[model samples]
Target: MKKVIIIGAGLAGSYLATQLPQNYDITIITKASAQDSNSMLAQGGIAASLDPGDNPASHEADTLAAGQHRNKVAAVDQLVHEGPKLIQTLIKQGMPFDHQANGALDFGLEGAHSHHRILHAKGDRTGLALTTFVQSQIEHVHWQENTTAVELLVKNGTCYGVRVRHDPTGTFKTLTADAVVLATGGLGNLFPLTTNDATITGDGIAIAARAGAKMADMAFMQFHPTLLSLHGKCFGLISEAVRGAGAILVDENNTPIMAAVPKKDLAPRDVVARHLTWWRAAGHQTFLDISAIPDFPKRFPGITANLDRHHVPFRTTNRIPIQPGAHFMMGGVQADLAAQTSIKRLFAIGEVACNGVHGANRLASNSLLDCLVSAEEATKVIAALEPAVTPALPQDPTTIVPPKLPSLADLRQAAWHNLGVERTKAQLHDFHTWLAQFNYRDLVPTQLSPKDFTIANLCLCAELIDTAALKEPKSIGAHYIKEVAHESTAS
Candidate 1:
């Protein structure tokens, strides 16, 4: 049997494990339990051309427009075209999707969606529902929890396996496989305020880069326009679906903030985030006015529960204190439609793979569909690959450590200030200098603790993002570089 090791236990990995052929031995390695994934925290629904009035062509056009026409045409085409069939398959297989009183599938709307093609389950708990459903179907796969992959095992330009450490016990082990797939999610944890799960510390991307895997679109990090923020700390995400339900961004005085911007509250995520960044920087508190949306609590029970836990009274007051927070990364190891990366026998799926579907900015609810579609595509190629001999492990000394290590809080703070929503050349240079203090790029230490490894990975990912941001000076999509205005002196 061909052994396959899949990193990450999110929707992509779980779904891929269930779809692979019987000849392949699948093993999933996760940093935490199966539930500790960004997929579980995703409040938005899956986007697909499921509605009678909607079609793949319309979906593709909306995706391209949201991506600023920078998306790979073929990749976008494949994602939209294949999405409906996959959704139908999931539905036929007993996936519980939200339905109207008439027993028809209830299609929701999100920003940039021209049609109500977004599918949800259990109200705002779509991700949780989908993740649990896919995980239930996974069988015949070895599960390794609390295992962090420190490095990818590559020999002669082909990835063969991974070196892992049981995070709690710190026991190291090397697992060799015929094929390795990275289903790890995005790098939202690089910033202080984020909507990402705790396990999403950019480990997969850093490990891939250190393994000499090609990366792409490293600069595009999407900030959600409205995360429930209390005193600058993120409480939780307020899904864009709320905005689609007639909520508007407003100031403390109940004045609409998006009134001047085209599309108003329904503008693309990057555009809305940019506005919120400037608005907050100008010392104004922003809020989401949800008074117009009928039956708020009944429609968004998950959000209502979160607000109740945080003691935010949504029923009496129709406003939600909001701020832009790091939500998703639109970049990672470069992969094709087949989910094949630059390295042979190695694949990247889900948020870890920049397959050009979400070019500059991701369309709302498209990420979940991307995960399922990519996993399906990857299963086909992985099942076809012939088994190969396990490559010999490297004999080099594995104790290379960085000279300087900053505290996790310090690193996150720096990332938030410099690489957050509005980035400038000065900010990028400052962040680059802060990252340069830790000469960790060249040193791939294999003996550090999981916490130390997380720090190192964050540093390396930060440097890559900084470098990419510096390379592209022009503003487009999510990578908005603000120009520092120079005051004219009396000359």
Candidate 2:
């Protein structure tokens, strides 16, 4: 049997493992626990056109409109057209999506969507429900928990295997295979305040890039508009679905945050995030009011429980504090429709791969759909592939020892300051210069701790964005740079 090594058992990796049985033998490796991922923290749901009135054409149009027509036409076409079928497949696999009294699927609307097409389950526990359910349906697959992928075993433009460190053993090992699939999640951990899990440290992207894979759209990082600002810990995301379900963004004076915009609370996340960031700079606080949504506690038990855990009291009359924070990444190792990366025998799926499905920004709830659809389609592509002769794995030579660097907290804080919602050319230039000094050489090594590698990936990814921002002065979509701002007085 042909062997395949898959990295990061998140949403896409989990589904792909379940699908690829007869074609090959597969082993799933995750740095964190097998089921732990950004998908678990996903509060909203997947977007799909299951209603008769909502067809793929309409879904495609909504997705295209949200991405400002910057998305790859064919990729978006496939995602909207063929992605919905996975919803039914998942349902057959025991996905517990919400249903109405009439036994119809309960759909909800989000920003930049015309129809109520998002399929959610367990209120705000959509990602958890889908990932958990799909994982439960797996029959036989090799699973490794707490094993971190340190490097891609790419030699002469082909990926042959991976070098991993078993967390418990604290020893490095190499797993050679005919093919390797990278399904690592996003790079949200780069920011001090993000809605992503700690494992999302851009490790997969860095490994691919160092092996000469082509990257695309590094400048387009999307910040969620409603993250509850917290001290000492990660920012808790207030899901956009909250607004879609009748919650309103209001200021201290009870004025709607998006009063000037046509969609009001339903405006695209980039616009809303920029507004909240600038609003705070102007001495104003942002809040989400659930006064319009009836039975808030019963309807959104998860969010209510989260608020309660944080010791924040909420009532229909009380507005929840909110601010913009780093959320989704729209770019990575550029891949094709079949999840094939630039490197031969290597493929990337989920947030780590930039298939151009999301252009400058991604629409809300489209992430989970992208994850499942890419995995399902990639399954067919891999199943038909003839296994290549596995070469003897390369030796891991003793590389240069990296110097003790500054705290990762310093890197994340800088990224949040200069690479957050809005940016300026001058600030980016300075940031890029500072990051260039390290130049990814500070943390590149064969045998290092996972946290150090994670910090390296974050710095490298940030530098990529900073470099792109300098070259492409024109800011479009989430990569917005104000034309001009005051020099010393600007906050």
Note the clash tally of each candidate.
0, 0
Q: lDDT tens string, model 2, 1-491? A: 87888898888898888888744788999998976898877887899999878988888887777676779989999998778887888788678999988999999888888999988889988888888888887657788889988888887888988888888888888888777899998899899888888788988888887778998888989999888765535457888888998998888888887888767788788888887777879988778988888787777778888888887666735667888888988988899999998998898889899999998879889988999888877877677768777676667666766655446989999998899888988889888877766636544546566667777778878887787767765767788888853121100
Against the true structure, what is every candidate's RMSD? Answer: 3.7, 3.2
Worst 10 residues of 1 by lDDT: 482-491
Residues 355-438 of candidate 1: C-alpha lDDT, one tens digit per residue: 999988899999999999899999889878888777567854656665467889999999988888888998899888778778
C-alpha lDDT of residue 25 in model 1: 83
Overall local distance difference test of candidate 2: 0.82
Residue ranges of candidate 1 with Cα displaced over 4 Å: 396-403, 484-491
TM-score result, candidate 1? 0.97
C-alpha lDDT score of every prediction, in listed order: 0.89, 0.82
The Cα RMSD in angstroms, rounded to one decimal, for candidate 1 relative to the true structure is 3.7
The parts of candidate 2 lying over 4 Å away from their true place are: 231-234, 484-491
